[model samples]
Target: MTAQPNSTEARDMAYHLHSYTNPRKLEREGPLIIDRGEGIHVFDNSGKRYIEGMAGLWSVAVGFGEKRLVEAARRQMDKLPYYHTFSQKAHGPVVDLAEKLIGMAPVPMSKVYFANSGSEANDSAIKLVWYRSNALGRPEKKKIISRIKGYHGVTALSASLTGLPNNHRSFDLPLANILHTTCPHYRTGAEPGQDELAFSRCCAEELEALILEEGPETIAAFIGEPVMGAGGVIVPPEGYWAAIQDVLRKYDILLIADEVICGFGRTGNMFGSETFGMRPDIMTLSKQLSSSYQPIAALMINDSVYEPIANEADRIGALGHGFTASGHPVAAAVSLENLAIIEEKDLVGNVRRLAPHFLGRLNALERHPLAVEARGIGLIGALELEAADGAAAGATGARVGAILQRNGLICRNIGDSIAFCPPMIITAAEIDEMFDIVEASLGELGQQAAA
Candidate 1:
């Protein structure tokens, strides 16, 4: 038998495999091993503090170590630790949460379905679209369309729906029926002298063209994030969503707003769909729903989408789709408590008040030599680093990201862009501190690139 490892690094290397990590590099460097978190910062096992600029994977809205969330989990665990929302079984937390989500939905929603993660919620949405199409008697309407830079999730069908190449490579993903539309990013899509409105029209035309090429009868849904989150926080160009939704409506394509990142005050609203005027037929939500205190996700369906499915389930005598932990009592209880805290603390109002400050700080970086573009909404933002005269697309991005990490601000390096998504609970002083660190890092990187 092999001997057990003693060091944290050794144990992690022996047993842990991390997602989105370079396996070979992890074997060499091991994990940072975060010990705990408070507010918008996390401490490594060595006591090194990092301003969690990405909000613990774009969630953690209320920040870390909220006693209310902890107490809520403990209360539920004591009262009813485990209960499934399957086979006609239900629990108070689940029922209450469903009501709360429906009431809070930007658009009118008929029901809520619980899942374990954003990926699961997205996967369920895909299944629901297919089932809805089948119920409408158009079995051919199964293909789903997403944009090139949009991020849905990472499950089988959801990963297929994801527009990024890396998510699809080596995974045999984007399964069979998933189609992609043009990314509505003007900076990348623009030709010389192309106006934003023209770019918007171009995107609409491209989507319409794709739908025509695929045949509208074969397309079931169109899914997208309100602001492209993992895809470098790319906000849509002027009139982008308006035009895209027009095309989808014309073709009768169901819209699925993947609000996993943009939901829950991340975009200065309760939901991104509201901020962006995206009237989706269905919505997938996670992340801030429980402030990442516990694992939970939800799918909100409109009456147009849910009634058929409910009827089909009644006719078929079984739904046959659900995780054992779906709507787990402990998670639902924590999520309910999290929502209450968000409302009581007026976190959404805080986001609206602080967003201009955050955006001002990020926009200030535009004049920095290495910064090509600085864009964001609410607390979520990105600074795209310009490549050296002839350097590769992501070369400077890697250097800037390393510099930021060393400077104690941990942000996401998505290609040539650095993404920032501070917790909704971030104070004005902490916001200033975060920008100061980022500015220092950018200055150092700019000097290095110039040299």
Candidate 2:
């Protein structure tokens, strides 16, 4: 039903232009303005509670209404509301968070550069890659390779790094010196009779072939999500990362793990790099960094990647890179508290314990008539829908997702897949409850499709 032209809906339609949304549809149907949240659930303007299955854009790891995060923000606000880390100036929160992140890194990291969002962090990483290569007197080594369907971020450079066509179609994106490799989804991209391991080799060969075709000297880095999140929560085929990393290492290309969604125990590890054996030269983190309570993101670079940039900065007399709120004190404080809560509550261990039930319930959805496959790891999962007869791709999944939304379960539909990544704090019973709604919604969708 189209929402009535009430104050909230009317104002939203009047003043807001939402990202990744069809504005025409928003004009007709309006928005679900959430009023509040508790735990993993949010209440709409009408006070109807729904499970935030996607965890508010795949962040919110510690869950909603987390008092510790709130109090942390408040305490920081009271102490030092805002401070900038530029021109050698630093604050306690920023310094402390950096130290904590460095110590907890999956691989040894030299420094942390803070940004306000995932997009900025990724865009900055690209710039850093270019800067580093130039500093090393390899200015031609500027091209970057990302996989098809990889979701990096939406800023200019970051969106170019993103492989989704929709993000680039009208934006004149993928600006230049950017190349794409084949998606690592073995289920759909593999050759007939080829196994996953073999397909992984094929993917690596494709990367190597691309590097050769483009001239290895021109390619500076390869960035990828540890588990592709917005791109249907794709877990790469077995041996995929190892093979791909081998090729990158051979070409002397830097590897960047974009752990924006898969970080903070989402993949049952501190970072997705650990979940999958990726020793990235650089890493981008966001989403759960501050639990989305305050916008924050960061990039960590290993010594090899950092040294050139540091030298370049020394040579140039200034780094010439940073945001005004690069390391805002409040965001850093909130992030520190979020990590501490995760530690105190053993949230990572909880995700490990609860993942089996989560994945089991998710995999069981494959039996649904409309489901083509159910794929998941840790707390993240997706149900790829079978296209209805004579319908376009993603039509059935979108329809079913809309039905699920109406039934009070919020998830995201990417192409034909509906993704679910609840907060790490979710309980086993809540996992079951979330899937109960999913089963009911899918069953209804099946009946509707048949009808």
Q: Which number leads on lDDT?
A: 2
How much is the lDDT of residue 321 in candidate 1?
A: 89
Task: Kindly provide the TM-score of model 1 when superposed on the true structure, using C-alpha atoms.
Answer: 0.97
Among residues 3 or more apart in sequence or in different chains, the pairs in candidate 1 whose N, CA or C atoms overlap within 3 Å are 160-174
- Residue 404 displacement in candidate 1 (angstroms): 1.5
lDDT of 1 by residue, 1-451 (tens): 9789999998988888889888888998778789999989999999999999999999999999999999999999899999998778999999999999999999899999999999999999999889888888899999999889788888888889889998999999879999998887789898899999889999999999999999999999999999999888989988889999999999999999999999999999999998889999999999999988889999999999988888888888987689999998999999999999889999999999999999999999999877889989988999998887788877788778888888899898998999999999998999999999999998897677668
Residue 380 displacement (Å), model 2: 0.4
lDDT values of the candidates? 0.91, 0.93
| Worst window of 10 by summed lDDT in candidate 2 | 1-10
TM-score of each: 0.97, 0.98
